[model samples]
Target: MYALGLDTTSSALTLGISNFDQINRYQTWDLGRDISIYLHQYLEAFLAPLSWSELEWLVVAQGPGSFTGTRIGVVTARTLAQQLHIPLYGISTLTAQAYAYACSLSKVNEGELIAVEYPGQRGSVYGSLFTWDASNQTLSTYKPLQYIDLKGWQQLLSTEEIHHHLSPDTVEPKGICQAMIALAHQQWQAGQQPTWQDILPYYGSLAASPPSC
Candidate 1:
């Protein structure tokens, strides 16, 4: 089975296609503020290798990333899923970042928590905690994504003993999309079919904390 993942939650437009475990194609475009203008254009070309009918489900980084970027990506995903009559899976931007960060690590102490943070709307940073699964190469959420200032975040990290903190700046869009697809592919394989109508993006200020799922 094949699936598609799009992450326009950053200035970069990241897209990927995967067949269960392995990603077949992945690309990232640093489109700055013009992502909305070209997302569909590049997406169409990115998806040219496979027929839409071949896609099992659609996946998107429903964020706590860029406000405008997240909205654009989710709306496009919902529309495509609606038209294609397929399920749409919303992967947390923080969750994807955790996975990508895990992949970047040379050695991850499996049970130790890895924290990911993104700059938020009003001077706070969005943070989420996750535990890396070395054997499975997967991640399990330790805490739901939430918004907090740097000081509060530091306190929380100390309280939680989360040693591995990953910066949002260091991650590449390709890694984000890869992680997005992997998360969705796992859910798809498990036979959880969520509708596109229910899919929504998580933006800070509006929704400070959302369930990791």
Candidate 2:
């Protein structure tokens, strides 16, 4: 069995392929402002040598990161999933960052929380908190994903038993794709299905704040 994963929620375009147990192939390219121009070419090249017929699932990081980049990734994923008639799973970009960190560190103590913050307009950030759930062998969403400014974020962090903090600049695309693949497998096992039509991009914007210049 084969599954493909994509992470374009940030400046990088990460692609992963899982041949059952682990990610067999992982690749990333920094797309920057040319994401729309290069996304399809890169995606096609990434899967060119693979056996697409055996690919049973598609997983993508769907939001709270680069507005244009995230949209490109999701739209591409949705199109492929629909055309291929395979199940698609959407993972939150913030959660993906946290999960990636947790996986990289190997063992996160129970109660150890991970916070992911991506810069947003007007000093606000797109953030989310996740805790290591030892019993479930997975990271659980402790604080719901939200938009908070630096001061507000600091206040919220003071209330948690956080072990790590991650920001946009620190994320590793490879790790993010790995996390996406893991989450996708979990959803597949739990019988949670995804509707391509329901997938949408989340820009994590503040109503009162104007766009960052």
Candidate 3:
């Protein structure tokens, strides 16, 4: 994949470089609101030994996450992809969490469902359902991302018979940079090439309204 991946959808910032082979490196920082201040410097130093020109692809977590953090990441990634003239793959934060967990499983049932959710504003939740195919290291979204009340989320999970329910509080969203990179690599290997313009940060009714422009 020879790609650089980023995840800044929370209080932390994560960066990773990978080849989907032997070469893999990653770092995470709990910068909170100070992330924007140190982001450029961290990225520059993290690129180490290899310059931006050497990266063949770019990957980032396009979130259903913190409003400000998600926008910052997507904008930075989009700009880099545009300037580097490389394909950019924006992975869903929910999918990355599911992907990471799924990778650790020893086996899967015939129709296993992995549900991931993050607490949204006002007791609502941002969630998605994913089915991971271990054979090809690919993840398919069984239920698309949505914002719903906790009661609705519980009903959906019970109705769908989800086998695994994951949350950021347990797995830590900042640690999924490698998963984002891996998912992007799988898609790229499958002959998928997404442009930077096609990527956008997902903010699902933050504060029950659209984020300020």
- Candidate 1 weakest lDDT stretch, 10 residues: 204-213
- Give stretches of model 2 more than 4 Å off: 205-213
The TM-score, computed over Cα atoms with residue i paired to residue i, of candidate 1 is 0.92
lDDT of each structure?
0.84, 0.79, 0.82
TM-score of 3: 0.91
TM-score ranking from best to worst? 1, 3, 2
lDDT of 1 by residue, 1-213 (tens): 888998888889988897856548989899999998998899889988778998988999888878899889999999999999999999888898788888778587778898988887557888888888888888988887887887888888889877688888767888888888878878877988899987888887565346355
Best by lDDT: 1
lDDT of 3 by residue, 1-213 (tens): 379999899999999998768888888889999988999999999998888899999998888787899999999999999999999998888888887777766675445898889898888998888886777666788888888999899888888877888878656554588788877877787899889988888888543332111
Runs in model 3 deviating more than 4 A are 107-110, 173-175, 205-213
Cα deviation of 110 in candidate 3 (Å)?
Answer: 4.4
How far does residue 26 in candidate 3 sit from its true spot (Å)?
1.0
Error (Å) of candidate 1 at residue 177 is 0.5
